[model samples]
Target: MTGTLKLPHEGTPGSSAEGLDARLVVERGAFRLDVTLTAAPGDVVALLGPNGAGKTTALRALAGLVPLTGGHLRLDGAELDRMSPESRPVGVVFQDYLLFPHLSALDNVAFGPRCHGVPKSQARAQAAVWLDRMGLTEHSSAKPRRLSGGQAQRVALARALATRPRLLLLDEPLAALDARTRLDVRAQLRHHLADFEAVALLVTHDPLDAMVLADHLVVVEDGRVVQEGTPSDIARHPRTDYIAHLVGLNLYRGEAEGHSVRLDAGPGITTTEDLTGPVFVAFPPGAVTLHRDRPTGSSARNVWRCEVAGLETHGDQIRADLAGELPLAADLTTVAAAELDLRPGAPVWATVKAAQTHAYPA
Candidate 1:
């Protein structure tokens, strides 16, 4: 422990600068990451995206493990950009629980506090409290290799919290656990995060994790934030095709005029909302209907000759991925699928009512 080790706050209730204020830009070997973010105390923000999207890079920048080419990082109100990882009032739970192989769970949890100058006896006592909170008191003497995946994750979390960080960053925290273990650990982690008054951020590609664990979602792609909002908001109104697909909606970019939109490709679509200029049109796969032949005198204004490119069973329904004038997806029940005799390379007519389509300004 150094004399310069500073506590960001007196207690968890009030935080350093408000919570966290970060605007980061890091350029590395032709890849660039730029993002701006802010969160109040008690807020849990998630950075979600596909592989190589720089979610880990942004997290590394906040932890001072990676240098920023531009922008700044502040937690509570103290500037952390110039500080080293250990000097900042931040704690991280990495994807892999990096507990020392030779150490017991109790010792692993005590190490952080001990390094920060807490007396050995005092740090061990505090470690016990955290282990108890994580339901690992009985396994405190077990080594990392002896613990289960879920147990190891709890110890890592306990160890991080033992240091009393005002900013908690978890990178793929549940990635190592199996499906059943992940569910249990995820539920436990949610409860702990709710009790934490400090700002928390996590990086993950799992939509369920982002939806259940975070209060806000920052969707990143190609080194930039494509969308950011509450989970419900992002689910209901996706701003980009990637997000739309992520939320399971078929999206299209178009120019809107009144109740109709001229799609960038294929035919124009009539929608429920009246909008002008560049716009986005979206609809659910379940809203689409497929017919063997083109029918007339139907209320549906959007119809296209589509060929089924593939079909797969999705729970109780079947998902058909189609390509044609409009590339889209359609969901149908097994009975309907059997009746239509749907298959790959099959010609089908797709129809969607104007009222089923949603249009929003781009």
Candidate 2:
């Protein structure tokens, strides 16, 4: 990729203070979405949630494709609440790339500039520069169907950047690629985002994508903002069960006294933290050990009688879902699982050491 290719609006006036500040609210049928977002220039924020959580709706509202019923949107001190999608200083890389089937890669990149009234020759010239930066100059003549998934993604991104947007929005940018291609494209996208000087918002369901590409995370649930923090902070201190599951931790809430926490779910567990009041206790699945029979005089402080609800292969480990006194998941080696003769409906004892658990304020 060429290092000298310059995007339009690189040094626009007042761009130093160009950032995103908005409270987005949209009402449709029986659903209402209310979310607040703020980001400084050069910040990449990821919006993550389960399906039907309004992630796509939020993106559409920002792009002016959906009208907001309440709240406001401001970018660089300009109100965009009434702006049309084509009039807003925003660029979006859609999930499917959405490249025109009949247009060549270069023509697709030039389309936005052409629509904005730039001369056809000048627009194509700018498109060539962008393709050069993306290291796709050789494929500029290929149609979208002829381009690979990764190549189509970059072309879409180049098209967005050519329009010189102050805010870039990506909707599931890597969701279309295969596993191996997703890995390579994710890294490439991260590098490109680092070079973007404007505020960027990314929507994705993958926790790893949010952690690797974004400086901050906003987790939406049921059309509302449930949590927002740095990826590390959110992963370490999940405030919701959905987040805990996303981060691969078995989480529970309970009333704490000293080092013991009596869970709201009916069981009690011992932790290493010394505190009182309501709290959350969590541990990794790998921290739990299962046995066919209760061990005698074990060092573990927490033990419960559980029955196997189900089992699944998780990478090289067996992830057993247990239901009983303290419902949770446990990861063990295949050999260990086989030795215990594990299966659905099988009775077993689960144990976790106090030091393996983490407790914090609820």
Candidate 3:
């Protein structure tokens, strides 16, 4: 790299601001992404969603890799709408790290400051400090091919931070690491993010990653923000089916009056919540009990005649997708699944105690 990245139209330079405020809009053929994101210093927000949900598009738009069809981007207070990617005060850690194959770890981290006109010696000195902070001092002279996945990731992060960007964007930062490496890197990344003085945004497919590394979660669906909130709140009171499924809960929408809720699909279930009007009912799959035949004199408040639509192993338990008066998922042990002879199209009765269900206003 003789000169800095020559990317076109990253953003427009302007007066400084304190935090990030962005409304990103990008159109490609039939897909149009429109999302707004805002955050303060030291905030780590994770963009999470299914494939084709525009999470990556949002990140790219922020990085100036993808042009914004509309909307605006600001970091601290500086407008980033028309600045070139290299000119914007932003750092990006790609999924694969994208470290230079020909450069050593120290040189790779120094590359950013070097591009900004810093002398070679000064840049290398800064790179050394970053490598020390990342605990990669021994690997400073190692090439990218010789560095492990975790080490490469840390180097990429250090490179991004070396320039002291006001906004940091990370795309699937841990996806390349193995399970063991991911666990360790995730913890290290979390600590770094906690200490980061600037705003940080990351895109990840893994719910655990979003929950652990981000202080806030932004769930985008169909190029729009479906939900954004604290991880625990979204996990507890999911407002959409996508969110419910993401959190491993069976969710239903209904009209609630006192303790009873009339489901949209024409079934009524009793809940422990005292609410009125529209409400959403949610319960974990593990809370459901399945029986081959209808049970009599059961104390459970919710029971439905159902047929197994599918069965799959979920970790150590079997997850059964049931279709009936009220469609939902149930979790059972392999022994119980075998005892019930669970299979697609097999008739079964499912029950969930009201106490196990959570109800919230829609």
Candidate 4:
């Protein structure tokens, strides 16, 4: 990992969050995925990580789609490790919506209830109510092929909820929608989730989606959970470089003494935090100031000699990926970038104030 690295302390999560509890271990050939996930009733937990990080696999495990090779699977204190997929109280919304091509929107949702022994009329009536709540009553008779991506996603969600499962698993629920449609569907999804009283677990690589829909976050990498915390906590103090990049911050691992840190990268940096022993130092890219020459008479003790490795526009700012005595990313305005004639291999210096840096025990 190119970012600040920290390994997860090995141990089970002990107690599940509240409503759903799971410690999943799936062994396929030489690869293994071990993850502990928990969510209280009414809580939304997100499994966020890079591709092939086992987020979807964890979701599948919860829904009983994938059998756990080892570890416990529980819902509301009931052991479900050996339960069959159909017998488990789980609802799933797949990334692709997985709707039946020939079934109408109403029938698609009614299918779950009907399979559970509900009368045909009663199931269809319940499906109608769910469709109304999803604002899809007008399209109830439309087949899956006739629905737009957003509509299809809502129908899938409605179907999942129609089962009234105690645990809901959504795999990249909004991944298939267009940008314009995603915004609208995301709002509706959030609204629906707010009303849902059951435990909900979603898998996604998009940080925005996780932050928006989830109450807690579990960052998985290489089949291991590296970090777990609230969205705000993870965003403010990312433990790994991958997480730092996800949250748009520059992070470093170092040994701390008071407010000073001796970075592992062979440079010393100062921060305002009072700490000691091993620690993590983090600062937003916006906190970095670029200078053609080291600035004179500044209170910012954290200064480094660097050269621009790359530059690109990010939103309203120009982000410069720097490599030098201290490796980090810097955010500069378009105006500042042009003034410095910032380009690849340009000699530059970066400075950050001690107060701007955050140091915490690793």
Tens digit per residue, CA lDDT, model 4, 158-250: 899888888888999999999999998898788888777778899999999999999999999989999999999999889998899999989
Winner by lDDT between candidate 4 and candidate 3: 3
**For candidate 2, what's the RMSD?**
1.8
Question: What would you estimate as the lDDT of candidate 4?
Answer: 0.88
TM-score of model 4 vs. true structure: 0.93
| TM-scores of all candidate predictions against the true structure | 0.93, 0.96, 0.94, 0.93
Give, for candidate 1, the lowest lDDT window spanning 10 residues: 1-10
Q: What's the distance in Å from true for residue 291, model 1? A: 1.5
Candidate 2 clashes: the total is: 0
Highest TM-score scorer: 2
> In terms of TM-score, how similar is model 3 to the real structure?
0.94
Off by over 4 Å in 4: 1-18
Count of clashing pairs, candidate 3? 11
- Model 3: ten consecutive residues of lowest lDDT: 1-10
- Model 1 clash pairs are 16-76, 16-77, 17-76, 17-77
Cα RMSD to the true fold for all candidates: 4.0, 1.8, 5.0, 7.3
> Which candidate, 1 or 3, would have the higher lDDT against the true structure?
3
TM-score ranking of the models? 2, 3, 1, 4
Query: Residue 273: error of model 4 in Å?
Result: 0.7
